[model samples]
Target chain A: MVVRRPGGRSARVRAAVHQAVTELVAERGYGKFTVADVAARAGVADTSVYRRWGDLEELTADVVITWLTRTSPVPDTGTLDGDLRTYAANVVREADGPAGPAVLRLVIALAAAGETGARAREQFLAERSRQLRTMLDRARARGEEAPEVADVVDQILAPVYVRSLFGMGPLTGELADDLVDRMLGTPGRGPS
Target chain B: MVVRRPGGRSARVRAAVHQAVTELVAERGYGKFTVADVAARAGVADTSVYRRWGDLEELTADVVITWLTRTSPVPDTGTLDGDLRTYAANVVREADGPAGPAVLRLVIALAAAGETGARAREQFLAERSRQLRTMLDRARARGEEAPEVADVVDQILAPVYVRSLFGMGPLTGELADDLVDRMLGTPGRGPS
Candidate 1:
């Protein structure tokens, strides 16, 4: 068995294929294109794509995982409030970015797809949960009060994502701060 | 213009066509079928669908509006807490229902399709906001404090929709109540 070197030809091909997949998904939406389309768009051999990814679903999942991993690095501010604000801001920025809508569409499509898509969605969410836990755990260790992982998901992440998904309005930094403030019960706005 | 009676053949045909559109969207996930397909499934003439909706996007928008109007009625339980709880519970129920996923998928598809889809998404969202405003206005008129419609959208509606979209877990009435409690800062878990 041959081992592939990191940051080599394999990496380049993978990046090219993933970019192609994202463009296709954004332009045509899910299931409208195929592995061959990706191959052609990437200027690679169709056999290579087939051999590497096995199917369109697997390839799409890999694209999602890769995209998410590259984009969202959890913030590590010293205070829980700072950390959460930064985290929420990062989320808003990403969701409003160029690739945001495509990735959002991809995630929803994967979740709605059958078993394989469900597994991909699970892996994506589990990774997100793990990231949040790391931030919250760090906050708790420093004797800072932190909301539960689920609370963060519901209050911060979910709302940002839903807003992006539905195009409710511009996802502003102020909105992120407000969410954190509300969750932490800081002196922002009282329950009216 | 020919006069069409309410609750007659016109209504029956509309119901059939709408049901057919929902089923198709549920089964195929959008952009897979055509007017002929819808007409065949709906047991109505293709021309009738064309004359009524003009295109799939218009038909889809109507479907979304019809579904949302039928499913969610603003709840009034004489208190802000009770009203929010019941409203959130109703949302959870609808999102967890048989047609929930279909509608969710359709909305996303519409939003991503183009200008037409964007308009549909806006219409759907505006109607939801109207419903929330009606509830909040009533509460305010009764001298009860009420959250802004945007807050409810972000805190309650967004989380539920995002959860349902991602298949995070079972959306329950308790969860709905918890959301309301968190929003209102009632006698529940403190900020932590």
Candidate 2:
């Protein structure tokens, strides 16, 4: 099972650590930020930080999980295209913001580390897959999606990921809508 | 502009370096493979390795590029679904191999490391985008795809990535065929 450590370090301490990690990530990027710096900024002992989270990569994963839970998987809106467009637009919008790019950098490095890093990445992906699976299950229950639509869902979601990881192109609002329309074969309609 | 120091080293030397890097990646993962290790394994001078490639990450990217070029793009069998299924199945087949998982681990890591590793990543993404765009263009020209089918391509491809990076599940052959059918919205098919 995947381990997710606690974030509440006595409210005040947790807030400080979070703020410190965020600022450092923004300033230096994930590659430059160290657990030592994070600890120093958080005013906690390095051991204390490690005690709560096993390592910097895992800790960063925890932070990413928290942020993703709050920000991503977008709203359902009862339409796949609309949901995807919202999801894609949301990524661009958020990524352009302060925390977004930094988070992206950190997670990539962690994931690449292999083993531990890969596990962290899986944790993040699980959240996304779970969200999609939930929506698919709901649609199945409601008879909104055909029995075979699960594969369609996989196809429909590929571009958002390709654009993000592979630097293919922008995930604009229009592109997102078009992707859903094309995949679902319901041109000009939102998910319903 | 992104720096791509191609063919700087002799073919034999480059091949040797890539081989060493591949072994190192498979055994220890990308994060653990340092320049010195690669240099020693390749029987090349450390300075030569550094002079040709700026860092371990850049070296990893170059090696990957070499690998991909050797693999070439999947051949067309006329139909879009056939092409995609071939492509997807190939990915699954390759990923199960030594170089496949090794390269995948590296790619996932690079994707996760957004800003801190910008230049190297930009080059990586550009390569991938170019390949996909070429395939999409061909698919469009062949009329195997509608005007909007490229979007479906992106969506269909995402799960392969999700599985690779997150370890959510295997990119099974069955899933690949199903994805192609659903995305194409062929006759006699439901959303399944």
Candidate 3:
């Protein structure tokens, strides 16, 4: 049995370890670094990392979850259109952020890495779908007809991600809004 | 100076080398293997691959171009809806194909690698955009109001790819038709 600290040294150490993992994944892709590398980069002892996360895969998954939760919290702007627009814009910002490409690559790599990676990918998708469902449920409660979770995924999220992953174009706010409009069947301002 | 042969031993050697590169990249992701590995897999001499393509980067780019051209030819079904439906379905099949995920990974990895990778990624996107433009142009000529190439990219291609990359769900034909319908503002059969 161990005494668990809620938001003290343990929280600081977890934060440091996650940042280290994110940077390493960004620079080296996946499967190229080790837990020891993460420990060293986080400026903590290897034993501490091992004691907490067990291995690199677990540590990497934790980092991805933390990043996703922190950066992409579900929006609640009162209306479905406003909620979707805010959600889409937030995604645009996150994908274009400094660590955006790295995190995207990490997620893609994890999806293809096998069972553990597949599990992480599933968790990420489930979390995203859950957030969208929350927004939709709220809109429905307000008597605003909501689109399926699949529509939000296909229309808004997919394009933003594809553009970012392939460097197709800048992820501007207008693009985000247009996607939301397209999904919601509101007349867009016409293509620029 | 080299003699040009359209479909002779030269073509055969090129095909073999491209196949080897595709398999290697699929199996090991990007930047993990070298020209010699490709040569060995293709049953060709290292000097032969070097003499023709110059380096691994050139060979990889050539493989991507070849794959994209061969797999994703633009369809001319006479109607914009038919054409989009066909195109979207083709993308689904490609993404679900044996080498689909590998090629997708290669393209993403290339985009993030460096200058050479960036150039390759640009070339790939340009080629894709050109194909879409041709289809859209034909639709306009046929008196149909075709959507912008960017619209198709954002609505159809992006979703298919994101679904494939993240394993979000099965990329069904219904999903493809629904996407085309959404883009065209057609009344969908309603969500299934």
Candidate 4:
């Protein structure tokens, strides 16, 4: 294999800075985190961090986007129901996992305030929605009839956010199955 | 009409305080605004506001509940699909209007943080869910078949919150129609 060198060091530095940012946001929330703090935690030079990211918001945009993008996988279970269950369960699992809802709320609140993080938030959702389209297209080929892919995707995923936010109910894998079944109109299908 | 006396004055004070809280939360957000600030803006005595509200969180809980309760009317449109269209469109319109997604994000963030406002957030969502139950119950009485009201309600309303928080596409009326149609399995129903 060819050895990669030129972009390696810079990529590693970016990774370190991002790790520091993620830890800080998860620990203390993103509102007051500073570039200097990230540099210290990352064990990189503050000047280098600043030079690469420009500022805290730019650093923050990347942190939010990376977390959201990697948290859910684009499942290819070969059918819409299977793919959607995987997809919905992934959304619930992400909501339940370590990053936690507080950080999520902070991101949404910032976007709602029309902050610079809006682009990051928008990019995050768009990527997820793209995966959903792929899943729906596969479903349609299998003779499923939901032409409104985005709308159906939102119905499957939004309940997780709503219930999570309201502290209303547990986000279980079963709930994910129920959601997909309801949307697809295939209730009581045996687990496949 | 029943003539109200002592309770009327107290109700008026509470309403004014809640109005001020809603405005302040919408204007400067939830973290910084105080009881004294609300009292000052509401033209009520600081002592009166403090004694009544106890803290910002109590006032905030009431504000969120009141706005959510009043924003939508339970539909009786003679068909489950029709009622759902009115219901889903109302959820979208509320997100698009004043007392908007920012306030919602703030409330959810507060609740997720395990603040006192968690009770308020819980109360607000419960009220909205209750309304959905009424509409769905009416549909059931008219011989519709979806018995899982809570599940179906979440399917319809949760997407509005998810899309709003993520700063996704506009919560358009057409999107609302698409959501109701997909959920209800009626593709080409005209307004009835």
Which candidate's DockQ is highest? 3
Q: What tens digits encode model 1's per-residue C-alpha lDDT throughout B75-142? A: 88888778888888988999888778678778877776668578778878887788889999999999
- The candidates' DockQ values read 0.35, 0.22, 0.37, 0.29
Error of 1 at A66 (Å): 2.7
Q: For each candidate, what is the lDDT?
A: 0.81, 0.63, 0.81, 0.70
User: For model 3, how does the per-residue alpha-carbon lDDT over A22-48 read when each residue is reduced to its tens digit?
Assistant: 878777767778888988998999999
Q: Write the per-residue lDDT of candidate 2 for residues A18-115, one digit (tens) a residue.
A: 78877886566554678899999999988878887878767777788778667665567776445555665665556544566456656655654657
Model 3: how far is B87 from its true place, Å?
A: 1.5
Better of 3 and 4 by TM-score: 3
Which candidate model has the greater DockQ, 2 or 4? 4
Distance (Å) between predicted and true CA of A1, model 4?
24
Off by over 4 Å in 3: A1-6, A34-37, A43-58, A186-192, B1-6, B33-37, B40-55, B186-192
Model 2 chain A lDDT-worst window of ten: A183-192
What's candidate 3's DockQ score? 0.37
Candidate 2 ranges beyond 4 A from true positions: A1-9, A20-40, A45-61, A73-85, A95-98, A101-143, A146-157, A186-192, B1-11, B20-41, B44-62, B76-81, B101-153, B186-192
**CAPRI-style quality class for the chain A–B interface of candidate 3:** acceptable
Write candidate 1's Cα lDDT for A1-192 as tens digits: 877777689888998999899889777777679888999999999999999988888788788877776687788879988888888888888898878877987888887776867877887888778878999999889988777888888888888888887777688998888777677873222242
Q: Residue B54 in candidate 1 has what lDDT?
A: 92
